[model samples]
Target: MSVWAAVLALIIERVWGYPDRVYRILSHPVVWMGWVIGKGDETFNKPDETSFETGRLVGAVCLGAFLALVLVVTQPVARLFSALPGGWVFEAAVASSFLAQKSLGEAVARVAAALREGPIEAAREAVSHIVGRDTAGLDEAEISRAAIETLAENASDGVVAPLFYLVLFGLPGIAVYKAINTADSMIGHTSDRYRAFGWAAAKLDDVANFIPARLTALLIALAARWIPGAVPGGALRTARRDSIRHASPNAGWPEAALAGALGFGLGGPRAYKGEVLDLPAMGDGRRELDADDIDRALTLYRRLLDVLLGATVACAVVVWVV
Candidate 1:
């Protein structure tokens, strides 16, 4: 039943992403998590007074409390759903909220559409919504790279990771994963204020994502076999060769795989807060990316989603038979 819930969640999220009206009315679960994280920061992180060591200790405690709250809230809901007739439908809806397949595709597609229809500023503005890098001065190649990289990375964390947990431990698994991921997104950074206080969250997020990230690369590699002009062998080779070069242990796997599949260079000399990060370039291909490149990446991404769904359905079938 939980396996079926994972299947249905992917289908529902594919058909209709999270609704704006529902978001307006109840806000989002991630938003609620963010609010809690914010409160934790305000209450415990008095930057002017707390020492670095104390901040790290407090951060671990806060993360423990936040995860406890997530489990407490979700466990009852899961049990209630389990007891109800056709309860997996409701469970599927809730689980769908955690996956971002529809939203991420639409957002990245918008960047391509913007580049096609409007000024570079429009593309930059659209890309800004998805990526954290400074987009103000990005050219067409950079914008295309940013959109593709985002598609690859988010495909791992936002879609695969949540679904992985949901399939393994049902609603509670996904809820806990999302809580930890959201906390990391909110507080995990290198800024002086959050550096110490967010250490626990950042490390935990890395641990949680390690497996899913690699799985995502493998899925992308498999997906490439069907996409014209995509290279599955290249994806595997580049992922093996270049993924380790990234600063983040998990992000590079998918990014490098995507780069290799599409034959586009990525992860080179990105600037954040005026500091240049000359990360090693992945893939031995063209560096001058364009709108066509974005379109190709989106095509590959959509294909990857189909593969993921097909794989999920197959798993559910096997479970049913067993």
Candidate 2:
């Protein structure tokens, strides 16, 4: 099943590629669904115990229903889209929607562009989409640091992880993973209301991403040597040493590897929703993050994407031939 899925995905990637229009359309449905479901929590959310428990119950049921709807809906939608005039075009659109290469690049590029246009404040605002940290009052280096960290982290979570699941189980797998991840992002935290209720969602996402995160780190390490001034051996060694230090057991691996590969440190103390959390750093380098570092991280991410695509193709061919 995995091999077959990989083969099909590879074909779509090579022939079709991702299209912006497809993403725009898909986003409408997915985001609207999330909004409708998420709004219930916002409306019912209250300081009282009864409201908290009720919100949790509603959230859980909504998430489950959403997941089921996506699974049921995507097949027909994909089939209908597949029937469009140009076969290659439709295939490319499907592949592109599934792939995050373009989206990730554009996201990071927007932050860089914002920084260029204005200042750290601009960069902070632009980067908030990709990161969870508080952005207010961040210095230039801090803003750059956040963007680079987000670039590296999303390269794993937003790109490689989805592709890994797509190759393993097709669109349903990818959709399911996205739903779970979205749910985690919505409520998974150590907050007063979510500590117990969100535990299951957080843990499930952790387990789902475990192998993919490490795989992404390995690819980043391999691609790092191509980056000028990067010490290949040192980067890999540091990645191994530092990946486990972050709060998340899975997120640290890729983020640490990218930090080491780019010869910078990431994942330090930052504020979150008025709370100051002392997060562990990811690499042993000095804190010298800058716009150039963001560019370098982007370069590394592009290379990693190419490596992943090539590997997927090879695996597909091997499976098909065998």
Cα lDDT tens digits for candidate 1, 1-322: 7889999999999899999999999999999999999999999987678899999999999999999999999999999999999998899999999999999999999999999998999999999999998999999899999999999999999999999999999999999999999999989888999999999999999999999999999999999989988899999999999999998999999999999998989889888877878889988888899888988988888888999999999999999999
Top candidate (lDDT): 1
For residues 8-52, what per-residue lDDT tens digits would candidate 2 score against the true structure? 554455444554576576663346556854774576444355565
Q: Which candidate is the best by TM-score?
A: 1
Clashing pairs in 2: 16-92, 18-96
Residue 162 in candidate 2 has what lDDT? 77
Candidate 2 residue-wise lDDT at 6: 49
- Candidate 1: regions farther than 4 A off: none
Off-target runs (Cα >4 Å) in candidate 2 are 1-29, 39-47, 50-62, 75-92
